[model samples]
Target: MEIVRPHSHRNLFSSNDAASAPTIPLYRSAPPLEVRLEDFESFAIDRLRVLKGISDGLSRGKKPDEMEKLVSELWKVNMRHQHASEVLNKDIISHFVLRLVYCRTEDLRKWFLSMECALFRYRFRFLTAEAQRAIMDEFDITCKAVNIMEFESIKEKLGQVARSMGQPLPTGDAIFYKVPFEDVPELVAGRRVLLSQGYAYVAMNQVVSLVATLFRSQLSKTLILTNRKWTSSIREQEKHRLTPIVEALCSSYLGPDFSQPKEYAEISLKDIDQLAKTSFPLCMRHQFDKLKEDHHLKHGGRMQLGLFLKGVGLNLDDALAFWRAEFSKKVGLEKFEKEYAYTIRHNYGKEGKRTDYTPYSCYKIISSTPGAGDHHGCPYRHFSEENLRAALSRMGVNSRAMEDVMNKVRNRHYQLACTLTFEALHGVPCDAGINHPNQYFNDSQKILQPKKDSST
Candidate 1:
């Protein structure tokens, strides 16, 4: 395994040469040279944010144009660069770092591969013809260009396929490639290209799909090999230093901290019931309902719901009063004060470590393991199919909406299912998708309580 040193401090490609260079990377090389601990973590986290943006857009069923717009905005924000070399080096180092982080599990590998493929396709589609050709040549992708004589014979069939895809027929001199159907299954499956015998006639505009297929195949194998190397050959000391970072990245929440309440109306104990009905996410609502019915919640439910309420503007006084009011019903005031008051105060940063813990994001909630009788984790992830269906029905999701949400759930896209549930209940698309419980609550409030214009 050859180690490739990252040229982050110097330019690998001159500015004049950037236009024709293949800026989109294949990541076929080994891991980059040693980076500082801080750089290593920050680079990986930033790249993960980009990948998550892509995943969220796709999961929410954004159309191709919408997804492209979303990804472009994300790239500009998270991956802005002053020079082409800087961009390529950061891209390379970040890809290798995330491979280490995501290679540990099958689910993680699938997610990374999917998002990376999407990223590759986005870059490939936007590149100049020369740049795309350079990448194809670099990868040794052999697709025979259809000659004029051969193209003339198939032009009508190809035009029909293009028209079906809502594209106009290419000019007489337009280029098409003849590749095995297996090389571009997505185009074949979508019927976006003409297929005759075993070969598929892919239009030049649709070549990104073929390149993306290759990237996915290569990256999938790399991730498995990375996992094997990670577990078996890496030095024990290196693993000791890096494993914690990998684990943290896997479960880390990169969103804004929701420890402090946003600028919303202050929530009192009396408003809790109404808010739970109209504004709370399903996880919090489930905990709220359980607490109301049972007069108490175990530790897991308390922490989950407690931090969420704190994030929603329930100050310390109201938090303590709210918990005590219900808990006292079961444990009596003496025991409640002794056992439960401290934890509530601690969550408010008034006792113990006074850490002021942030509310759990969807990532954290979904990653959590809830034991039997606990209603702390994400419902979309933790609920059985029958239970999820019943929960959606209770939320007044229509039959069609239920099917859409259930389909996302069946595909193991729990967050997407949650986003669909939000859309179905609210009657609007969750454009950014639901990343945090607080985000869902805030979005719901924006809809349910539209602010009045003071000037008016």
Candidate 2:
């Protein structure tokens, strides 16, 4: 498909003069005047890689330090390479490329919005005071700071609450935002602020969260418009240009070559029991053990465990034989053939639709809500606090480490909890965040592998 240059729009060249300025363009489709054809796609993909890096870090429950490092690296490598004017233009242009590729489906739109929000939030956090003011003016963000003289009256009440919460009182020089009372609900719920009339007084540090919310709201509305604008035209030609981008986006989060037999072809049925014992993530290992003990797993467990084994290099024949051997012990071969053989073959793309299925990503696993008697989904997410703690204990996680993992789980940081678990199990710091179950397994394998001698 030909990548036709988009016709220039008026907003692409908006002036700084307020009197004649146009509305800020949300997503810029028009290419920059100086960019080559190769640069256009390269710029979008580079930005996408950055976005993926941010999302992947967040998905893995990366700490504030890790996130800040990611933002720093991104600025150094990508953002700093462009001029000041090109920075904003590149952000808009790269966004439009992904929008065109991802706007066709609800799932894609959701993924697109999430990564864009993360990207916007990260960039916003690093903007200088003057630059932030400029962006706010451009976007018509009128988040007013409360005057110091006016804040003096509420200072006593603020100090009282701050002392009660064991937080230091903001000094006379602290900056406060006069936001809507509803916007900073956490402060309101915690009674950390003074609410006078309708407005909530919030500290300057909390303003970024409010700003991020506003950015997300605006971007969401813009994406709806973008989806409508692009859906009708994202046909054969557009698909040709975007197919690789979509695949790469998926690969960045989902495991690569999920449907192929490259990494796992040498893995035979005899090896699965030992491999699973040593290499599987906690979620998959739990399922593997349960299937062995009970001689049955619910559909959810089967699907998750089945696809995982496939990605780990279990071939179709070995997969069928593996399941058959386990189930035949409980139900006999004839019954196993009648009830389960087709589903196993189906998962292998041997039956209807013939669609080669991929293993579920970490996001998919954690997000799934299992039904009764189902032991399929993420342990951190699916298990209760007590149950999760007990499970972690059995896996040799110390009480202190387990407490930390539990805290992450309680705060809905399941991926981070998994990372902590990975660290504890492997006894090393894993530099990369876990995005896919296959990634978890692969990382475990690498960590467990013996170090080669440099002399060799």
Candidate 3:
């Protein structure tokens, strides 16, 4: 494939030869090539990791510079290729793969759209002025530059809007673009641009927001169209091969294998009670408490808590013993061994399918819906506000910290709320935020038992 590389040394704000510059993709059309299934899966996963990083950083309230640094590091590790052409190919192919994967459901579409827009904005910021203009032209984003007379007429209003938005006042020489106010509602809503007669006067620096608006609009429509096409035609034809891959990509957990605890500390049954207090996330801690109190747990709770124990380094023998001991208190050893023993072994890949089930991430836990008697799901997501508050209080979280967590929960940022809870309990900042229950446990252990080399 022929790839046109943008000028490496050109500053984002500086002009370059527009004819030779490669613009960041709008992902309007699919790449015309046959990709190996292995490469196809790899490309989709790499792009998914990037989008996941963007989602994580935004949810944690990372500023633009912090988000930029985070994304840059992720791109270097996951998306960068040895050759420019390979990089371009992966970029295009990965986007299309994810579009197919995420276009399945409304929730998936919204998430994909949001993260892709963020990725676009991040990449667009680093493009040279010429490359950006090339994109604008290619996409037919016709935002007319205001003439000197119109600029002079709106100069005072623009200055006032800029002042209100804490931006520097625009000078007479500064260029402004006139786009329909509907096209850049965010800029108008934030009072970052001057508006007159249904048009927004956007300064050059703010044009990225305008362009982002256009990119988002275009991508949103494309996703819906792609979904309609997939439903009407693609589903039946590709059900066996490509469809399965797309479905797996949507539901797959791309994080570390928590089932294998080779690097983590060895956890014994004797250590579980103390560890629950110090290391468990709120969800695990809740389940632990419930199990001890009732001496029995529903299937949902058992699976959730059982897999978490496995992740924390409970060996198969210890796992069996732990469940047998807990259940024997209510049902005698005969009944316990008959009913519950196999289930525990199954989680260790000892029975049925012989698949080593990994511990649930926050996403998995939050996505699950617990019933009236269930204790499986994420507490931050499943608990009523009153119940959540009570749970926090029981953990000795102060009123102020509880409120902070509640606010994040209220906004539907469950993982962030969990992170806040972690910070409150640990008395240290959780910079990356918590993604999995096991991650929370690992992070807590690191803080409580600092490594000897680090101490030195």
Candidate 4:
């Protein structure tokens, strides 16, 4: 520990036992560069969880606003989860390449389709006549593409997708009456194409537009709708109300669209982190950048550090440890723990008893965020390309394996990434040893005893 500003008061936990208790490793069991460098998107797996919803519902109009408001209200009520949500919304999406891989069997996949349609059709229903025909045409192309194999399984899955889309059958010519929306002239007689096709970029456009609209309306009323000559008291009232609304407006503006309605929730962390570097709040990036430069860390490393600190409900001591390990070699520990550590901790979430906590492990690092400060997770701009390469190299990975994993992530193969990484690391399936990263970490803490160099 760095020499402190000597205090006349003896400290509470700074005794020999405290120092001897083994300062929790700020970098224990840190996988080698190879293990840590699984495509940057891996860091975003949990952080971008909320984007899946934002990405999907963004196309809806008034409803997405209501949804967002509801989410905001939920955050207000469960302040404990706020940090986690923020992590998901901003931090995770900014870094990881999150995606959904369709790896279901034909019949099962079809059932999945039915479930989705049943769930989302009210908001983004079956395709319209023009769009349906277009989809059918595309379906023909897809079918042709699948001639590589029997593709019967794919055919069934496509049929499921069609059904989920509210199409009665596969987007193919079946021996049945093709019920085109064109057939129901009355359906379109007055509905001004109230919505667009499913394949359209619906989510970001719609949600963002609605949020934009409501935000603007609220802003105009609160900030600009006044006669400039209002009394001081009235102006004060307006200012008080306007401030929060304005902030919400700015947030909504930054948020994804709610109108266009398509959810390609393939979180591309590299892209988003770059955006954070270029566009996010300045105070945020410093915390992670410090970690990166000092620790030779990558984007994932920064994210992991942020996430673990957040997850463990780290107090001032642990928070200080984090910066000490990451930045001491560069700036010295005193500067961080006394100055930066407190700032980072305060930003992480509320400190004190009954605070939100999750296991500090790869899983939580990958999947925990509460959207507000209560539940912690995420470090700003923590990971970048260079550090990521180093971390992956240490983890027994190479350019070829990294390439394979990254490609899989780009293709939205979440499960496959987990499966492949596990196989590569353990020479066995993940199920062979432990089920989840949480389980692995719990066991590792016991099995992989703290080394002389490791933190307790």
**Top lDDT hit:** 3
- Give the per-residue lDDT of model 4 (tens digit) for 237-297: 5465333332232112222221111222122333434423432221233335544554534
Arrange candidates by TM-score, highest first: which order? 3, 1, 2, 4
lDDT of the candidates, in the order given: 0.84, 0.72, 0.84, 0.34
The residue-by-residue lDDT of candidate 3 on 197-256, one tens digit each, is 898887777778878988898889999999998899887877876788888897777778
Off by over 4 Å in 2: 1-66, 72-90, 93-133, 136-257, 261-264, 451-456
Ranking by lDDT: 3, 1, 2, 4
Q: What's the TM-score of each model vs. the native?
A: 0.89, 0.62, 0.89, 0.28
**Across residues 1-456, which tens digit of lDDT does each residue of candidate 2 receive?**
224455332223444643343223344234444443454566677676777677667766679877988867874676444345455555556666666656666877787788877766666667676565565566666778778887798898878867887888889898887878877665678677778899887776666566666666776776677677665654544566655554455334423646554543558687788787677888998999899999989899999999988887888888889999888989999998998999989988899999899888887888789988999999988887888888788777898888888888887878778888888888897766666778887777666655423335
Error of 4 at 396 (Å): 1.4
- lDDT against true structure, model 3: 0.84
- Off by more than 4 A, model 1: 1-21, 31-34, 82-85, 163-166, 189-192, 195-198, 384-390, 393-400, 451-456
Candidate 1 on 1-456: residue-level lDDT in tens? 222235334444457865665668788976425555666777788888899999888777789998888888888888765654577667777888899889988989988888898898997888898788788887788887899999989888988887887888877889899999999999988878888999998878888888888889899999999999888866354666667887789777888788887767578788789889888888899899889899999898999999999998998999888999999999999999999999999888888887988998898898899998788998888889899888788878899999998999888888788888889899998877888999899888888776434335
Worst 10 residues of 1 by lDDT: 1-10
Model 3 stretches with alpha carbons more than 4 Å out: 1-21, 147-154, 451-456
Query: In TM-score terms, which candidate is top?
Result: 3
Clashing residue pairs, backbone N/CA/C < 3 A, model 2:
264-313
